[model samples]
Target: MHERTHKVNAGSSKPRRPAAAGRSRRAAGFTVLELLIVITIIAILATMFAPRLYGNERREFR
Candidate 1:
């Protein structure tokens, strides 16, 4: 029978951070430019579709 021995190092006490730790520190928010772009896209889409939505609703109520 063969026995394998495991060795633990005492010099390093804190556990090593995972590879994902590098990515986890990112600030969670949209930049101003990104937010403006998203808002502009949404506004344009709403403007383009608003007439159709309101027009149909008005016709249905009559």
Candidate 2:
């Protein structure tokens, strides 16, 4: 009884790899369209706010 229980416990304790492999088999990285969308959003935000911040700096100098 003790030996059987020990074997069961040891088997359960060992990490299983099939489940992990199944999870990682799918595509994981970002697509090009996603990267382009992020870049475009950043560019638009910078354009919208950069001049106002720079203008404030110019006023401080003057």
Candidate 1, overall lDDT? 0.85
How many backbone overlaps does candidate 1 show? 0
Alpha-carbon lDDT of model 2: 0.80
Tens digit of per-residue lDDT, candidate 2, span 1-62:
45543334455777555666865745687778999999999999999999999989999998
Off by over 4 Å in 1: 1-26
TM values, all candidates: 0.52, 0.56
The candidate that achieves the highest TM-score relative to the unseen native structure: 2
Q: How much does candidate 2 score in TM-score? A: 0.56
Candidate 2 error regions (>4 Å): 1-27
Task: List per-prediction Cα lDDT, in the order shown.
Answer: 0.85, 0.80
Model 2, residue 2: distance off in Å is: 34
**Number of colliding residue pairs in each model:** 0, 0
